[model samples]
Target: MSITSANQLELLQTAEAVAREKMIDPSLVIEAMEESLARAAKSRYGAEMDIRVDIDRKTGRATFTRVRTVVEDEELENYQAEFTVEQAKQYMSDPKVGDTFVEEVPPVEMGRIAAQSAKQVILQKVREAERDKQFEEYKDKVGTIINVLVKREEYGNVIVDLNPGEGVLRRNEKIGRESYRNGDRIRCYIKDVRREQRGPQIFLSRTAPEFMAELFKMEVPEIYDGIIEIKAVARDPGSRAKIAVISYDNSIDPVGACVGMRGSRVQAVVNELQGEKIDIIPWNEDQPTFLVNALQPAEVSKVVLDEEAGKIEVVVPEEQLSLAIGRRGQNVRLASQLTNLDIDIMTEEEESARRQAEFEQRTKLFMDTLDLDEFFAQLLVSEGFTNLEEVAYVEVSELLVIDGVDESTATELQMRARDYLEAQAAKALESARALGAEDSLIEFDGLSPQMVEALAKDGVKTLEDFATCADWELAGGWTTVDGERVKDDGVLEPFDLSLQEAQDMIMTARVLLGWVDPADLEPDAEELGDEEAASEEAEA
Candidate 1:
C-alpha cells in the first residue's frame, strides 16, 4: 500500500510501459501491482486480517482496505476477519449475517525490499502472460512455413526471432551445408510447438519434407486453389527432392503447372534451396503408372507389383539401369519414399535370366522330391505345383483330374506325399521345441498342430512375438503372373492358409495372456482376411 495520490499516475505509467515491453495486457500488470501492495500491507497490519488493494485505471488512485464479513459466531473461519451480526451492527447502522464491509487502512510506504518484491511479482506475471500468448499464436502454425530473422547461434543451432517469440532450428533440422548469419532472414517450417516448464518453445525446420510441399504451394497457383493436391513429398536435403502432385481437374496437368513455362515456378524453389534439384512427379491412382512417372527420364519396360507385400519390381532397359538407380541409389530410394512402396530396380535382361533360373530349379526339385520322372515332374511343375505341400494337401478328386493320373495311382501318390509331410512336420516340431518355444504354445487351444509347427519354424516362439506379427506375414498373400495362374512361373507362391489360420489363434492367446485387450487390434482389417480365425473363435 505504498502508492500515494501525488505520484499515483507514475505507477500507472510504469505498468503500461512494462505491459508494452512484454506484449501483455496493461490490466494484468496493474493487477499484479495491486497484489504486491496487499502483501506488504499484511506484514505491517495483523497478518490474520484479510487485506485487499484496488488500483483505479484512469484516475491512478489506490484504495487499501481490510475486508470483514458478518457471520454467526460458529461460522467464523478466521475470527480476525469475521464477526457476529451483533458485533458488526455496532459499526454499521444495519447489518445482516451475510453482509461484507471494508475498513480503510493507511497505505504502507514502499521500502527498498518491498519495491524489489513488487518488481519480481510484475515480471513473473508478465512472463506467464507472454508464454500463453506465444503458445496460442504458434500452435496452429505447425506444418506451415514462416519467415524469421536469425538471432543467434548456440551449439550449431540457430535461434530465430519469430514475430511472437524466439524459435530454435535444431541442428538436425537444418539442411546440410546451410549456414546463417546473425540478422539473416530465412523461411522455415514450424515443425512443433511445446509448452515447457519455463515457457513455450517453437521448433523450426528447413529439412522437413513438408517444407518443400509448402514452398510448392506458394509457387504453384493450382495447388493453392484446391485444384491440385500435393499427395506426398520426399527429400534428400541440400541435393534432391521429389513431390507427387495430383490435379482434381483432369484438364490441368499438375506437373506442368508446377514446372511452369520455361521452368520458372520450379526454378524459384530451386534457387531458394541453394541449387537443390527438384522432381515434380504427376501422381496417379494406378501405382504402376505412378512408379513410371516417379522414375522419369528412365523408361520402365515392365512393372511387377506385389500388392500384399507393398513392393514394386521395375524392369528397365539395360542401358538405363545406372540412371534408374541414380548416383549412389538416390533415385530409387527417393522414389520409394515418395510412393511409400519398396521399389526394386532391375534390367530386363536380369529379370529374364532370373525367371529362367527359377523355373529350372523348381523342375529339378519336383523330380528329386517326388521321385517322378523329368517329364511327369515338368507336367506337375507346369500345373503350378510349386511346393510339396500343394501335392500333399491336394484332394484326391483334384489329383484324378490331372492328366495321366488314375485312381489307384492317385491313392498311392497321396499315401507317399502324406508320409513325407508327416515326417517333415515331426522334424520341424522337434527343432522348434529344442530352440525354446514354450510348451504352452504347442498346447494352446484352437491352434492347429500344423500351424504351431509353422510358427515355431519361423522363430515366433513366444506369445509376444506371435502377437506382433504383421497381417501380411501371417496371411502370406502372394502375387501371380498378371492375375493368371502361372503353371510354370517360379516367381510367385500362393499364401499358406494354414499359417493364415493362425491369426485368430494368436489374437485369442494375446487376450488370454492379458498382453492386449480383444478390443485393440480388432480382427476387422488386420486378421489376415481369413475365415478360420473367426470360425475358430465361434467354435470355441
Candidate 2:
C-alpha cells in the first residue's frame, strides 16, 4: 500500500507550517517520523528488525531500510536479534559477530499501526520542541516586564495567559487595592522563570521593592544616568513612600532632579504606584539633620541620638508632635526605617516633665541623706550641690578651700561626713536586696543582709544606692560588685561622677546579674543636658 505524492506533500507542508508556528525546526519532524518507524518495525518483527526511514521534504519521497547482524551458530540468537559474525561477513568482508548490516526493506505496507505510531511521535516531538523554545525565550527575560492577558482568578489570585505559556500573580505581589479582570492587559515585572513537567512557568509581581526602583529609573533621567543615587527607599505600597536621594555630582540637586520641574517626574512615579504619595528628601551626611528633614512638614526642636542603641529621640513643639509622628506614627515610623534608627518622639511639655522629674529625684536624694546644717545646706545650694552624691564626693579640703569655711571646721566636717557616710553605706547594703541588688552584693565580699536592708531603706541598693551616700561611706569599707573597695569620697571628689554614671553602673550591675530590670535605668540627665540647656536658653 502506498500514499499518493500529493498526500505526502500535503503532510510535509502541514508539518512545516506547524513547526514554524511552534518555533521549532522542521527537519526535527522528519527525524521524529523516521525514529518512530524504526521503533514500530522492531516491536512488530522482534529484535532482528532494524530499519531506517527517510523522507525528502521537497519531493515528499520516502525510503526504508532494515539493519541485521552476521554471526556463527553459537551467536545465532545475537544475529537474529541484531547481527553476528558469519552473517555480518555476508554484508561486509571484514565484519565481526557484533557487526550490524543494513539492508533496504522494500517500501512496505502502509499499516494503520505504523502510521498511527508515526503521528503520535511527530506530535510528541513537536510538543517537546515547543516547550524548549518557550523556555529559551522566557529564561532570558527574567527580571524584565511582560504584558500578560488576565485569565480567571484561581483561589483569589490572578492567573495570566502569557501567550505560549502561563504565569501566576500571587495575591501578595498584586498591587494592593487594585483589581484585574479577564481579558485585561496588565504589565508585571517577571520575578522568576522555572521549567516544570507541564511546561515553562513565569512568576510575576507588581509590589516588589525593585518595581519602585525600576519605575524611578525609568521616570528620572538623573537616576538612570547614575548622577542621582537612591540612597534608601521605604514604601507603604499604595499609601505613601519615603525615598532618600543623594547626588554624586556636587552641582546637581538630587531631590530637585527626582522631583522634576513642577514635580512632573516624581508624580509620574507616584501615579504608577497608584497615587502613592512620595516624599523625595535630600539625604544628609549628618544623621540629625537627615532625620529632621526625613520627618518633613513638621519642625524638630531637637534630635538626641543614642548611636550605640540605634535610637534617636526627637523633640517637637506641643503642636507639632502629631505632625512629627504623622498619622498613626507613619511619618516617624518610615523615617526610622529609612534612617535605621528607632525614633522616640516627645512634645516640649513631655520633655520638660521628664527633666523636672529627674531633677526632683536628684534633689530629694541629696536633701534626705546629706543632713547638711541649714547654713551649710544653703551654701551647698549656692554652690550647686543639688544632689547628695556631689556633696558626699566633694573633698572636705575643697570645701575648706572655699572662701567661708576654715581648716578646723573642714576637719570636723570631714569627720562628720565620715560618720554620715558609714550610716548611709550600712543602709545601702541593707536596701540592696529589696531594690533587687542581691546578686550585685554577692559579687562583693562582706555584703551582709543587714547592710543591704539598711541601704534599701535609704534608697542606696543599686549603683543608685550610693547616689545620696557621702564619699566617706564608700571609703570606709563599701565594695563594688567586683569586690574592689569603693573609692574614698576624698579620692572621688575630683572625678565628680555624673548622675548618669551612677545610674548606668546600677543598670550594668543588674544586667551582669539579672536581679533588676534593665528598664529601671532612666535616660541620662547629662545625656540630655546640652539640648535642655539650649531649649531653656531659647525660651528665655
Candidate 3:
C-alpha cells in the first residue's frame, strides 16, 4: 500500500482509538507509528541511510527525511549517512564536523513484508506503553487492600483480573487451604509490584498481617481518622491473628473500638479472613506490658525483660502454662511476633526452681573464691551481691547493711574479695602473655586483664586487630535468619561490654594507633554529645 494513497486522517483516528483502548497516552502511539514508518522507509531506501519519519499530530501527514552528518575522514564509516568535511564543500560554503544535512525524501511504498514488520513494531511499542502504565498504576497501590475477580488458577496460583491489570495470589500467600474458583470475588493486600522481563508482576496476599490492619482501618473510624493507630500485627493465616493498637484520645478504647458494638466490626473482618480468630490487644510503650496483653487468656505472674537481647521471660501459674503456650506454641509465637521479641514462657514452679539454682550458683562462687562459709556467702548473695567484683568494689557501708556484720567485718570481707580478684587478674594476665598478647593490647586503658585474655584467645592479639573489629563482634548481637533470631556471640560479651562502649573503645584504639585522625572524629563526638543533651532534655 502506498503511504500517499492511504487516508491521512485514518492514521490519527487509529492512534487515538488504540491509546484509549490501552489506557495510554495518544502521543506514545503516534511516536510508535513514526518509528514503524521510519523502519519501513529504511527498507525502501538503503538500510545504511539515516532516515526518519515525522507524523503531524493534527494533519496525520507523514514526512520522510534523509539525514547525513559531516564527520572526520577516519570517522566516516557510513558513506550514505555520514560525509567528510571536504566532501561536503560542494553542498555548502563551509561544513564542519558534527554538522547535519537534511533533505526531504519521498514516502516509502509498503509491501506485504514491510507492512507486517511495521504492524509488529507498532504492536510491540503499544504493549510496552501499556505495561509501563500498568506498572505505575499498581506500584502506588502497594500496601493497600484492593478488590479483584479471580480469573483462573494455574498450578495452585490464583490469577485475578484487576480491571486495569492482573495480579497473582501465589499459593503460599493464600490463607491456609482456602481455594478459589473462576469469577470469585476476593479482597487482597497489594503486597508488591515489580517490573520484570515478562511484564509488571502485581503480587497479592490474603495472609499478610497488613491485610488485617488495613481491614481494621476500613472498619474503624478512629483508625481511619488517625485517633487510633495499629501498632503491630501478627497472623497465623486462616487460624488465628493478633493486632496491637493504641488510642490517642482518652475516651476511645482502641481495642474496644475495633471490637465494635456486639462484635459487629470484628466479625466483618473475621468473615473476610475465613473465620480467623483475632486477639485485639491494647498497645503499651512498655514492651513487657504489651507482651502481657499479647499473651491473652493466660495470667502472667511475672515478666522479665532483656532489652539488649530483645528477649522476654514470662512466668505463669502451672494451670495457665498450657494456655500461655497454646496448641503447638502458637500463642507464644504470635505474641513474639507482635512484640518483636523472643519470648520464654515458664511455669511459676519452674521459675522458682531456676531462681533457687541461680542463688546456689552465686553462693557457691563467693564461698569458694572469698574463702567464706556457705552461710556467709548466702548472706552476701541474698544482699544482691552476685559476684566477687560486686563484693570487692562495694563501699564498706553497703557491706555493713548485712545482719551481724560490723565495720571491721565489712572491711575484712572486701579485703578477701579484693585479694581473690587480684589473684585471678594476675593469672589471666600471665595466660594472655603466654598466648602472644602484646603490651599494646594488654595495657589498653579500658581493657581489663581478663578482657585481654579473651581477645588473645580469639586471635585479636594486636591493637590493629582490635581496631579492625566491628562493634557487634565485640558486644554481641541478634540477627534474623529465615525469619528467626539467631544469637551472635561476641568475644567481649561475657565481660558485659555494651555496643556503644565497644564502639568507643575501638575508635579510641584506632586513633591511638594512627589509623584514624582524632580531628576527623570531633564532628561525630559533637553530634553524639548533642544527641545526649537532647535526650536528657526530652526526659526532663
Best by lDDT: 3
Higher-ranked by lDDT: 1 or 2: 1
In candidate 3, list every pair of residues with a backbone clash.
Answer: none
TM-score of 1: 0.77
On the 0 to 100 scale, the lDDT of residue 100 in model 1 is 90
After superposition, the stretches of candidate 3 with alpha carbons farther than 4 Å from their true spots are 524-540
Question: lDDT score, residue 83, model 1?
Answer: 88
Better of 2 and 3 by TM-score: 3
TM-score on alpha carbons, each prediction: 0.77, 0.57, 0.97
Top candidate on TM-score is 3
Error of 1 at 134 (Å): 1.8
Give the Å error, residue 205, model 2.
1.9
Q: lDDT per prediction?
A: 0.82, 0.71, 0.94
> Cα deviation in Å at residue 11, candidate 1?
4.2
Per-residue accuracy of model 2 over 141-173 as CA lDDT, tens digit each: 887777899998988788999878788999988
- In the range 369-429, model 3's lDDT, one tens digit per residue, is 8888999899999999988889889888998999989999988988988888899899999
lDDT of 1 by residue, 1-540 (tens): 347835879879988998888888899899988988888778778789889999989978889999999998888788878988888988886898888988898988878887788788877888888899899889998989999999999999999998767999999999888999999999999999999997889999999999999999999989999999999988999899999999999899988999999999999999888889998898899999999999976889999997745789999999999999999988988898888777889898999999878778888977776778888777777777777777888887877877998998787777777787788778767876877778777677754556666677677777777776754466654344652222221101133443346467657877878987877775576566567778888999
